[model samples]
Each structure stands twice: as structure tokens, then as C-alpha cells.
Target: MHFDLADLRLFIHIAESPSLTQGAKRAFLSPAAASARIKALESQLGSRLLYRDNRGVDLTPAGQRLLQHARLIMRQVEYLKNEFTAYGADAAGHIRIFANTTAVTEFLPEVLAGFLAQRPGVTVDLQERLSRDIVRGVLDGSSDLGIIAGPVNASGLQVLHFSTDRLVLAVPRNHPLSTLKHVKLKDTLRYQHVGLHEGSTLLSFLREQVEHLGETLSLRIQVSSFEAVCRMVETGVGIGVIPESAAKRHSRTMDLTIIELDEEWAIRERSMLVRDLDALPGCVRALIDTLLPASGAEPPSNTPT
Candidate 1:
């Protein structure tokens, strides 16, 4: 069945919020008006879109299926608007991006600084989330572009490798490991470790590597951001592992010692994910040229498995 953008927007909002009232507040419509619109759309579609009980409102099975397509359709509409907007003024379109903590704090500033310098009219709106959430944002059409660590696989979107980073082990400057040029996995694991939350890609990689070495990782703390991890390391809480680039950036205040992981783990790829490569706007094209000039859309990483 055909649907308008407004109908799809309403459906998305309703599906995201637990209650109709919350959805109504987000859409700036009264509770009665919001309920009426939902009912009208349900009538047109000839199906119940939501189910409400003690747990508040939730989308029905059909609603879940429709929401997927609705998101894709809405993304295309936004792409069209951006393309036209770019035509009005060179490099003057909105680029919404979602990035992980490391990408935002360490990677994007230089790239965006150059991008904005070249395209003064273009404005960037950025959302910082975990790597996995950033991928979801790109897949869900909430973000036009995303930068993240690790490998991401999605059906329609294209992934391009923009850079590769070394994952290093960091400890307080005075820690015993600090004097070593390179640390063995066993030596590093002997001390308490600071890790990311369970599902974080960085933690997964480190944990897997440690597990393969027949060692149990002793985690002292699990924080969401690398900055927090560094701060903890400074106070002798635990040694933290993160991207080498990030550790260097924090070296001034963190007073942390960093060493290369002697193991054969492949370097992490810092990649850019876009919905459709060929459909990129001019400003996007310019940014791509700046970031991946000679690479020409490379794969995630060459780190040996």
C-alpha cells in the first residue's frame, strides 16, 4: 500500500516511544489528535498497528515489517532533499553523521575541519554513540554517514576503509609494564584490566585474543568511553587498552604509558559507511575525496586473521 512521509514519520515515532502520549509529545500533537491519526492510518491499512496493555503500547508484527520499509523510504526522501539543497549553494547541504567516541574525539575533527574549510556552506550535525549504535543509526536512516571501528556488515549500505589504527595497551607511567618496549599477552593479563561493556567491539576483540592465549581476563572496571578508561588508568585503577591514536592524544594529561601488543592481532580499520556510494551529494563526494583520496573504497582492514 502507498503511504505519505507524514504517515511514516508518525509510525516511526509511535514505534520508538513506549506510550502514545510520549509519541504525541514528540510530534507536538495532542493525545487525542495523535490517537486519531494512528487510527486513520490503521483504517487505511486495514490492520492493527499497535497493541496496548499494562506495558504501554507496542508495535504489532505487521507494524515492525512496515517500519523497516518506512525508514528506507524516509531516508531516500531525505537524500533527495539534500541533493537539491546542495544545488542551491555549493557545499551547502546538511550532513548528519553518527560516530563512536574514538572516531568523534580523535578521527573526525581533522577531517571535518578540512571539509568545512573547503565547503563553508555545508553544515554538519553529529551524534556520538557506541560503535554498534552508530552502525544501527546508519542502517536505520537516522544518520547520513557513520564512522566506527571493527567490521560492519549490512545488506544495502556500502562500507569503505578510510584508515587503519593500532590497538595498544596503556597503563600508568609508573606501572611495571611501562618499562617494557613490547608486552607479552601473559604479562599484560597478569595485572587488572579495564575493559569496555560486554558488547563493545574493542572489548570483544581483546577478550577473544586473551581467551585464545589461554588466559582469563581480569576486569577491574567497565566504562563506556575511552576517556573514562584513561582517567581510571591515571589513578592506577587498571590498565586500559584502546586505539594507539587515542592514547597518544591523551598523553599530555593522562600520564599513561602505552606499548604495542606483541600478538599478531590485525590492526583495526577505521571505516566510513554510507547508504549508497553513487548517490552521494557533492559535499559528500568532496569529503570522500579528502578522506579516501587514493584508496578508492577499500575493504575493512588487511589485519591478518
Candidate 2:
């Protein structure tokens, strides 16, 4: 190889972070070492690759051009490595996955169990983050794959609609809101709400629905995970709005109640995102094939009526 993969990898990190210090931290190299590698790469190409300013680093015309090609070359290298690895062959590799709280808690458990059973040697690192983090993780190379809510837009990643999940309103079993047959969007907003953090897609969707009704949802407390939101609702902190699938897990064991959000603003789609499916590691490929077969998962029975 005329240029080392490490060199291009470092460049991509620098390009994304735009800070030699931050990029070096992420790449696990000293600032001086990272700088020297870029300098050498620029020298070999006989071009100025970066412009440093008070603000941060900016890629020069040459740098931007190389980044595109470097990404392509890296994908090719990854695909080459994947080809030689066997199916279910204890392929040792890293797969960083990001998923929304609902999928992480409700859907991923069974999928992961099956995947690990087939490929025990493979390691799975999973994160429970919101949709934006999942998309950003793929773009930043922090995660290899992400599963999240609909309408996640990212230029650097390949997104697939692997599934659709419904969102519903959850309340304590004895709460007043639990009496509604099917909660309308307007009705749901009338109650004090317990919500996921601002990072969550559910929160954003709730905000949009409330706004469309010419009202604001009164969010009493914002929590990080869907589980926390459910716990809060169970404790009567306030009514919560979460994915129905997520609500189902707690429904069996807790005194919580769920109702369908009225027709106008109900169903939301969830999806799978990959940095580049063609460039996936063998273990990742196997896991994907098992968890998200071409048919995609059917809407789970847990969806609220």
C-alpha cells in the first residue's frame, strides 16, 4: 500500500474534529505524532492539505478531495477483510452499535441473544442513545450501525427502514388520563407530561405534535432513558409518552397503563443505519442478517390499540 490506512484514518479523524489535540485523542496518538503523519502525507502528495486558523483546522481543496477518495479506499479495505472471514467463524472484530432507548430495551435483547449464540467469539458494543446520536455516531465512525426513529438524515451514512414502531401515551394505572379510550393528541397534551430528554426523537415528535395543536406540552421532568421515563410515570411523577413497544416491557410487571395516541399523530417508523453495509466486518454482517432479515421485523404485538 502506497499510503498506510493509519495515515488516512488519522486524516479523517482530524478532518472531522478539526482539532489536532482532539483528533489525536480519538486516534490514540500524541499530537506530535498525528501532526507528523499528516505532514508526511501532505509531502508525499506534494500538496497543502490543511489550513490552521484561530477557529480550528479546515481542509484545503486537496484535503477535501483526498478525504472522499480515502473513505472509498477504506471501505474497499474493510470489504476485502470481510470476504476472507467465514460465516459464524468466531470472527474477532469490533462492531459499535447505537440504538434508541426503546429498541435497545425492547427489541435488541432477543436479537442480540441470537447473534451472540451464533457468533460467541464476536463482541458487541451497544449504546442506548437517541436518533441524532445514532446518526452522528455513524458519521463520526464512533458506531458501525445504528437503529433509531424515523427521518434521521445524514449524508455520510446509508440508512435503511428496517422497522416501524408505534408511540403511545403511558400513565399510572389509576391516573385520570388512563380513563381515555384512545387518547387524542389534544387530549394527551392537556395533561402534565413526563418526557425523555431533549435528545430523544419522542420528545421532538411530542413537541411537534403539541405545536401543531397550537399548544405546548407541559413537560414536568426530562429523563435520559425510556426506562427512567416509565419509572417516573409509574411513580406518578406525570404521564409519559413513549414507544408502545417500550411501554409493553414495563406493563407486565408495573402498575403503569398505556393508551394509543389519537389517530392524527400516532405511528412513527424506526430504522437501521450503517456507515457502509458493503464495508461491514464479517461478524457485523452476520449479526445484521440475523436480526434484520430482508423481510424486516413485523410490527410487534405490543403496539397500543
Candidate 3:
């Protein structure tokens, strides 16, 4: 079987248009020519792709499935072009990034995975550092950029609003605190908890926050990862504080509920920082573009607030 970009584009046009003739016109092909191409495509795939009548054309089941994939392939091609076109060809290099616990643990891995998959020439040295330290690293040339949470005087760095890091409490469905929408960290300190294992960046950060209140987390059990903590919480071992994203993912299958923390620190904007956006390398620029997709994020009107 033979399939190509031209076939995919022609198929997508036909699937999207009101009639086969219009689709062919949009694709800059004669209607007869387009019809022959579609028949050929159908023969190659061993399936009927569309149903034609006097009124118009409608996609068959196989056509619908093909349409889905064809659209995705077109989108990925467009994205690849955009990633490379902003600067010239992508340059091979390493991007040193210092990010906070939330970015490092919850979001960066998945975000980086897709970016790395497309650009094999690029490599990243990612380290989890505190927000202030991340800012300092970007400032002093220690790193190309940083993803930071919470506030510091990020005066010299170029800040692009990243994801929101909302730390929420995961409680058993029938637990007393489950009825409450928000619970302050200080109020929850008295209860037993399930926490990430020692040396976990987030756990260390939480320890410092609690220490500020002259109290400590009463960790009854320690787990290696967020999912484990949620599993323990589901069994009524103890409540756990984890990223809302992680909690929501686990809550679907577990008997758990997420309660927001009644503290300013609980909700903070995670911002991407670079010393100079204009002066950045092409690879760094491409990485930034991939991370800040148009959906679920606005084009960053950058400045430290």
C-alpha cells in the first residue's frame, strides 16, 4: 500500500468539505482527478473511505478513522514547521535549565518528552532548584533558563508565565476534611499524613514551609512517588498534599477528593525565565515554543510582575 502527504491532504480536504467537487477545488485538483486519487487511496487501504450521493459526500467509518489521523499528521507537520521557522534551522546544543520542585516533578518530564522526541539534536540538563536559586542561575549564566514557582525579586530575568502550581490536599472520600473546600497547612499539621519519600524536592520544600509555622508534618508513612501517596490515602492511611494535576488524575479511580489549601503559597504561577529572550539560541527558543502551546496557554506577554 502506498500513502503520502498529498494523499493525506486530499483526503482531509474531501472529508472536511460539503461536497467532493469543492474539496477537489480546495486541493487545486480537478474533480475527476480527485475522484481517481480517492479510489486509488481506498484500493490501497482495502477500505471504502467515503459514500457519495447526489447531494454530497459523507465519510464511511474507515474514512472517519482516516480523517482523524490525517488531521493529526497535518497538525504535527505544521507544528514542526513552526518550531524550525522562528529561527533558521534548529541548532544542535544543550539547554541547561534550573526549575523548581513542582515544574521538575509534575510537568517538565511530560513536556520535555515530546520536545525531545522531535529534536534529537537537543539535550537538556534539568535540575530541581528553589525558585530564588533558579532565578539566580539564569541571572549569573549558570543556566539558559528556569521554571520557577512562588515569588522572589525576579528583577533581572525575563519571565514568561508557565503553568500554575496549585498544591492541593488529597483526602479519603469519607474523611472529615473531605467536606471542606479548603484547609490551611497549619490546621492539617495535627493529622497524620502520607508524604513523598525523603529527599523528594517537594517534600523538602514542604518541610521548610511547615517549619516556618514552628510545626512539622506528622508523616505516618513515606512513599516513593505521588501515586503511591495517593494509593495510601485511598486506603485511609493518611491525607497527602500533592499537585492538583496528580490528585485529579488519581482521583478518577481512587476513593479520593482534592481540597485546596487555604494559603497563598498553595496557588502560584510557575514562570519560565531567561536572561534574554532576544539573544537566545534557536534550540532554546524552540523548546520555549513547544512548552507554551497555544491551547491552554496565552502567548506570553513577558515581564516580571
TM-score of each: 0.77, 0.75, 0.66
- Which pairs of residues collide in model 3? none
- RMSD in angstroms, all models? 4.5, 5.4, 17.8
Q: How accurate locally is residue 109 in candidate 1, as Cα lDDT from 0 to 100?
A: 82
Q: Over the stretch 94-181, how does candidate 1's per-residue lDDT look in tens digits?
A: 6888876667666578878977887767888877766667777777777778887777766666777787787888899889888987
* lDDT for each candidate structure: 0.77, 0.76, 0.81
TM-score of model 1 (CA atoms): 0.77
Residue 198 miss distance in model 2 (angstroms): 3.8
**Number of clashes recorded per candidate:** 0, 0, 0
Rank by TM-score (best first) = 1, 2, 3
Pick by lDDT: 2 or 3, better one:
3
Model 2 TM-score relative to the real fold: 0.75
Which candidate's TM-score is highest? 1
The better-scoring model by TM-score among 1 and 3 is: 1
lDDT of 3 by residue, 182-213 (tens): 89999888789999877666787789999999
